[model samples]
Target chain A: MFQTISLFAPQLVLAFFASQLLSTGAFAKRDISIGVRNFSIFVLLIYSVIGFILGKPTGTAFKGALVIDDFSHYMNLIIGLSAAATLALSKSFFQIEKLDRFEFSILVLYCTLGMSIMVSANTLLALYIGIEMQSLALYIMAAFNRDSLRASEAGLKYFVLGALSSGLLLYGASLIYGFTGSIEFTQISEAISYGASPGIIAGMVFLLCGLAFKISAAPFHMWTPDVYEGAPTPVTAFFASVPKFAAMALIARLLVGPFETIVSQWQQVIVIFAILSMFIGAIGALVQVNIKRLMAYSSIANMGFALVALSAGNESGVKGMLIFMSIYVISIIGIFACILQMRIRDGMVENINDLAGLSKSNRSLALVLTVFMFSIMGIPPLLGFFGKFFAFVPAIEAGMVWLVVLALIASVIGAFYYLRLVKIIWGDESSHEFVEAPKTLRTIALMSSLLVFPILILPLISIPTQSLISRAASSLF
Target chain B: MLIAISFYSLAFVSVAAAFMVVASKNPVHSVLYLILTFFSAAGLFILMGAEFLALLIIMVYVGAVAVLFLFVVMMLDVDFVELKQGFLSYLPVGALVAIILLLEMLMVGAAYFAGETKTVVVRDNGVSNLEAFGQVLYTDYAGVFEAAGFVLLVAMIGAIVLTLRKREGVRKQIPSEQIARTKEKGLKMVDIKPGVGIE
Candidate 1:
């Protein structure tokens, strides 16, 4: 019982806040709302700190529905910190947009809770619930600006597609349950370890399709561009950064845990998704004018890179994947912080061309964006290079040279757009007058950008992360 | 043999009613057919020894949901003929999807019948099935039950958030503003105003 409660503490804390916000009208005041938001961030930060400190590996609880381990703890810290930063960054955006409702904070808290649940889930049932919880909050958040037609369209589109994916996931879950005679991951793993069944393969394919949709991988990535383009900017940032970790953690756990035995069956699917996503993300971003859509493609490609690590199917692969995910999310949040600061005549600007001559208008912000762009392009000595290196090295060591080579080519193609953005920022002639970004956004961008250098200098943090990742990887077997 | 006859007829009626729900030309007739479908489905559930499920179907689907559907269908002034105009054009695509679903279901049934998989045997634990279900739901699946509640809560919140709007000129009492009104602001002294009207 204690174990279960501890594992569920983040969600419980969020729920407590949500209930308070709903029941008491006092929290509707702006000051009270800000106070509640800060309290929430503090609570989540404390919870994540406690998770890190008590990183004692608890195998399974609640009859194997929840797993608490180093992987989940690591994820908790990453997700919690990202959420805290997102909330802090939201303040200026909300104030400017005149959307100062307390419900926004409550919804964000719920989204964080959902992500935490997904990271810790061990059963298909728990995993589905977590995914839905997160998706629902996201759908609401996307449509939060109901007065805007674009936001409503984005919300409806996301809701429809998200519902379809949830259906696919449910169908797959039922199929697995039918075949394995149990919904528990351990039982399913045990059942399928001996030999693969066609039914099981089909179920696994469906499940991967659903997971692919969540991660915005190819063939299932139809909704990403539109949703990202249309959703409110801060919500879009949250969508990009927070859910990726949880969903990827889920995929890693599911693939490395229950589905590990039938690697041959699922590995092909993962490879296909990875290659398709890489090429599609690379090719699709080239002609995009919208910065958000471009970032959408960039994220898809990055997920493909991380998926390459997962497809390697080894301890080193899991370690690489974790490092890649953390660094990738950090970079995304930083870049988006810069994007959120883009304004022309007090209205938000999203067109890539609008970034012309950013260096002249605001050199510091431009410099921060440049660092992020280079990191994303996988330049040497940057954190993103190591992220890609770890992701690729494991795959190559596992003898997936073809996949790695193709991924490298795709990265080269993807770099074109990132470089184009950089050129637009620094090289092009000035067009619109740029405004100084909020202090909070600037701080977040600077901190994330600056932290990337530590990975280069220390190189020692990887050692502990590697060991913990391996321990988490071994727990599945 | 009698039980089998009753079960088969119930199943047949349910299936036919379900088809009629879509095939009926009139919207009201369609709703009536839907109610029939639900009734037959509940009867079939009872025949299958799932008494609790049958009661739930009647209570939730027929009692509340179907009635709600009836109200909406009756209240809406939709042109049924115009609505049905596109039915023929949509039929082919819908049929294709239905066929695919049917084939998938058949495949699952075939797999189950092929003896390659084990059928789960739910042992009778000497308690009523309903009692057993409740016990298991409350114990082993309690966490999931709570999560379900959260899902419903989010749905409620989403609905309210999406549809809620403040109307123009709607006087909403702001307690803070009301409470902040001091005696000086709310009242003024009237000293001999009536007697000094000449001035």
Candidate 2:
């Protein structure tokens, strides 16, 4: 019992502090939104450090429901850092919009807790609960600005679609349970190793479909663009980065864990999802005027690339997925931070045209935005190139050369919109006079750009990250 | 034989009440039918020897949920006729959904019968249903149970965060102010001996 409790201490600490923040917000006489937001950031950073320190001891706790290992630790670190960054980014936006509710920070904390549980889940029950917890916070956050009809519609649409996906997941779980007589991933894998059953295959398909929706892969991505466009810029940033990484990590765990034996059955489905997402994400972004909607498509394409690596179904696959997602999260956060700074005299801008001549107005901001765009475009000498390189090599090694080629083509097509944004920022004439961004947001954007740009050149940062990712990936197998 | 008869009767009642729940025009009547359906479902659970589930169905669903539904249906001044105006136009899509559901169920049934899926056997443990349930829930599923608690907490917070607004000019009670009221603040020692004189 002591062992289990100690192994689960990080999550417990997060939940404890979150509840404390909730009560503090509730009882405080004066508005303490800034304090709460800063405190949440502090707590998240502390949690990340603690998770890293506790990364050495890898074991299952609570009768194998929760697995504490390098993989989970890596995911926790990503979730924690990105969550804190998101909170810091939201501070100025909230104040400007008069949404100074301390509950926002507390909800982000709880949402981070949910993602933590998701990455560590070893049982289907834990997985479902974790997903629900995360999604509930997200639904509320999506509609945090309740006065806007678009925000309310986004929330309702997300909730309805999310409920449907949960139902499908539950049905799949029940089917798998019925066929295999267990809900534990280890036991399920054992059962499958004996012999795969038709019911199990169907259940796996259903489960994959549900998970694909959570990751916003194609065919299940109908809700992404609207939700992204309608949500507040900061909330959309949070939506884009942390939850995507968590869901992708969860998918990796599920595929490499219980479904490892039945790879043949699931690989095809993942491939189709990958192909569709790449093409659709690439093609869909061509006509979108809203920058957020374009990002929504970009994320779909990014996940498609991650899925390509995941289709490899080996140690390198997980490693590549983690690396790709980490880089993706960093660049996306930087991009959104830049987006958050797109406010002019009237209000926050969302159109691609709003970025016209940003280079002329705010030189440094434009430079940072250009770097992020190029990085996401997978231009050489940037971090995103390595992310995509690592992702593609594994799939090619797994005899998925055709899929890799297709992905490369899709990425080439996807680069057009990114370059367009750069061109608008640097070449086009100035349209709107942009306001200066908050110090914290500017710092975050610059820092992320630095990470995406010079970190590749600096061996110190790249080597440690590579070693950590490899250890994390090898632990899963 | 007795068990079978009781099962069939409970099932019949439950299905009929469920059908009435959707078919009934009056929202209040629909809520009442929903309660009846819950009751019969609880009865079916009892027949299946899951008394704990039966009690839960009665206590949670019939007792709390159904009552809430009744209150909402009674309190809301919604026009049911206007709401149903699009029913005819939506019938084709609804029917398509119904057909798809029916086919899926049929497919599942066929797969179950044909596939090599083994039925899970319930072992006859000497403990009561509630005790067994508690043991499994608290021991094996303790982590998941705790996580579920967090999910519920998120729901609660989400509800309040989304809907609870402190509007201006709305009179509300301040408990501290009420409690801190002293004799000097609450009571005026002025004696109005005569109403005309006081005026």
Candidate 3:
């Protein structure tokens, strides 16, 4: 019994604690923050241990739906750590709003659990389950503040768009099943080696569409900006960071594992998608006034960068994509944590222009934000540059120099907006003054922004991070 | 041959009701039409020798999800008049997409029918669909299977969370005491005077 229970120890532990937290209404009345912060710490310390242990396990468990492996273990670690940051960020946001925290924290935990499952999933079905679990929790968080009209509208729009994507995904799965006669990735891989028909290709297209929606790739990214803008800042931060990491890993896992045989077929589709996504993400973000919306477009471009690596269909490319996304998610979380800490006369100051004269009022926050902006713009020494550098190198190695060049152009174009934000913060003092920062806000901003220090000092940690990337990517291929 | 009739009937019902679900004039009619579609789809699953899928369709989709839809359609004061807006505007594109889908399906069906006749070797391992399915669901194909369950679970939870709300105009019961009730103290059978009803 102990052994059986131990097989599912990670999931069981997460689920048990999540439920206990829910039933006891433990954090309902408190700062709503205390629970989330503690939960974040608990998850981080525990999962780091479990991730190492998880990678050491061999063979299949719970039938074959789960593969406890080195690759999954590394990804689980990255995803868990990202979610922990989200939790820490959430605590500060809740404390600021004085909103109910029980429901919010539980949703984040469950969502993290879902993403973790997706990274470890051995089947397409498991991946979808994980995606949906993360998505559903996110949808609620988008509209968690039901009182806000925009938030409610965001949730509704997200739901409708999300439902359409899910339909396409299921239809694609069904069509794939039609061709392979099996939904298992390995079986499908074997079946495809013999070759696939147009029906199968169509299914793959629809499958890509569903995933694109999740990651906010172009042509399927219409819902992203609105949803991100409407959602609370912390929720937007989580959206920008955690789920994308999990989703990208799964995307790499799926393509590198079973779909490698048909790279030529899918690569064409992915290239078109990637180029469009990069262009649209960069171009669309340029004009956006809302910081969250700009980030949404930025995310679309980021996913496009990841896709460029995916299109390479090689081990290094996959490894590069994972590492790139890890750093990208870190910087995004750090940036957004600062954004969440911003205060106005009302709840928040959401517009870009409102940030004018920030340096005069809060010099420390402004300086940290400049670091974040530099990283995002791919400026040297900051973490964001390495993310783009690694992501594009794989493309070049794969003989996708044309696409890499396009990505480079897009990144250059994308940098303007980040620089613009910096100008607002540091350039000139405007008439408007920043409202006082709460203790919670100060703590999150200080901690998350300090995260940039490591990225800036990447020379020190690049080797270990690089090795983890190789180890993580080794399992996928 | 008898199996063909059941298959044809289920297929016809599925297609026809699905059409009605889109074409119905009234929102209520659309909801009812969708329920019919679900039932027929379930019946089709049964004819395909997938007993579990057939039951799942009936229990989860037809029984619960469809009922939820019906309740929403029934309970909501939908301004059915506004639904007519842009109907004609959407017709051409919708029709084009539909026709393309139909053509694609027919082409696939033709190929499937043609292929089976060429390789008609029977290799049934005396295995239930459930057994092979379970194996695949757990192993190499496990990701897709779990994704299906997770998607459904998310949808289910989302439905409850999104819809079960307290609207400004609508009254809702508070569940505080409902949850706090002890099994020992909640059930009381006391007589009251006819003119004085218990408040």
Candidate 4:
């Protein structure tokens, strides 16, 4: 049990602290700061150190179903770090809104815990369990604010669509299990590649649909904007960033490892999704007024970029994805942090016009947001530029010139909206009143702002980062 | 042999009930049909030697999800008054789907029957089937399985997110405000006296 306990130690600690605080009635209905955010961050840091200590694939829990590896360990750190950022930013948002205290942080931590397990899965059963755990925690997070009708609506819409996707995935898994007479990922993968059973192909298609939804790729991304718009800003930010990383990892791991040998079919499927996601993400964001919805579209477009990297089906592509996602996640955190800090009067302050004269009010916050927008636009000298570069460089290297070209157009289109946000923030005065963000909110903005500068600090790190990405990619094979 | 028949039967019942579930006009019938489908599927699973999965499906899907449907149907005041029979327009599409399914099944069956294949003898749990699955699961193809699981996990979370959500502008309390008041312990009893009373 101690062995099993070790695999779970990180999450256990989160749960333990959350329970102790919540049960003590300390933060239960009181002023925010249940210390949940701080606790989650500490737990994540601990998990990272422990995971680093464990190094290669090691299992201490769940009878080998829940195992830790370099891939999962690294991702756990990312998820933890991102969750921490989300926590740091959330306090001010809640403070401004005058909403219920920090239970949302606990919810966010729980979801992160689920995602951590998910990335560590070995068997089909473990994989499913991890995913559900992550999703269930997230679902609550999405609708954490009970009073907001839109939030509840977002949760419901996500639930219905998500349920359908899960059913499809389950059906597909069953088919794979049935055909191969096994549910182990490796065995079934071999059965698909060498055997090429019709069941396997069908199963793969079904499974991909579920993956598509998670990544919010097009043709299957209908629910993204609605949910993004409906949920609270920080929760939406979490959706826009962290989950996609895990989803991309999942895609890279599953498709490349198992379906690479049968790339023709899977590649065609991915190509369609990639093309659609890019076009939709770019074109859709063009007219959107809501910042949250705009970010959602941005995420959709980003997923397109990630998928384009994925389409190449190699180690380079995977590395590109990691770099792309890392940078993208930071930029998104910044952008949403700015959005979270906005103190709107009409509950409609999310509109682009509402941001007019922001430059006059909070010049510093305005400037940080500008950097985030540029980064998202893939402008050079910003973190967003490198994310796009790393993701695309591999595609060109893979002889995917056309994809690179289309992606460029999409980037330009993406830039259009991102700059619109820039203009709205720094543009001429439309309103006299300037929204002020609390101290905690400022930190998130600063961190998000700093993400743009990290690229300048070390152009050399990209090489090693790409190397790690490549190694992680090959590890799947 | 027994296992195969039971598996096929369960699958058949589930499929049939699934069709019926959609076809039935009454929500009650639909709910019942779905439950039967789940149970049969569970039975089919049992035949395949996945005791855990078989039991799990029955317990979770049949026992929980389908039962949930039953409760929802029972509770909701649905207006079946305006419902009319629409068999005429739906027939062609239904028949088309059925034919396609039949063709697909025939193709699969034809390949199996026409091709020379060795019979797979059902082994008795192989000393331990769980261990066997676990061994293969952890190695070689672990990545794909994990990815699929992540997909499911995301879906589950997405479902919860989609449903249990709220909107902007609704007033709520700050977590800090709630906790700070309690820690300060502001409710203190102070002693006050008048000069006349003291005398």
On lDDT, the candidate that comes out on top is 2
Candidate 4 ranges beyond 4 A from true positions: A1-33, A53-64, A345-348, A454-457, A460-470, B1-13, B42-65, B81-121, B125-199
Local lDDT at A262 for model 3: 89
Interface RMSD of 2: 1.5
Can you give the lDDT of residue A334 in candidate 2?
94
Q: Per-residue lDDT of A71-181 in model 1, one digit per residue for the tens?
A: 777787788899888878788888888876666777777777777778888889889888888889899999989999999999999999999988888888888888888
lDDT of 4 by residue, A375-461 (tens): 778877777787888888887987889988999988888888888878777766857564456777788778668867665448596
User: Where is model 3 more than 4 Å wrong at Cα?
Assistant: A1-8, A26-33, A53-55, A438-459, B116-199
Question: lDDT score, residue B78, model 3?
Answer: 78
TM-score of chain A of each: 0.96, 0.99, 0.94, 0.92
Tell me the docking grade of candidate 1: acceptable
TM-score of each: 0.88, 0.91, 0.87, 0.81
Residue B178: error of model 2 in Å?
A: 8.8
Q: Arrange candidates by TM-score, descending.
A: 2, 1, 3, 4
The number of the candidate with the highest TM-score is 2
- Residues A226-251 of candidate 2 have per-residue lDDT tens digits of 99999888999999999999999999
Chain B alone, model 3: TM-score?
0.63
| Docking quality (DockQ) for each candidate | 0.37, 0.60, 0.29, 0.09
| Residue-wise C-alpha lDDT for candidate 2, range B109-139, written one tens digit per residue | 6877886546675758788899988889988
Q: List pairs with backbone clashes in candidate 2.
A: none
Question: In lDDT terms, how accurate is model 2?
Answer: 0.90
| DockQ category of candidate 4 | incorrect
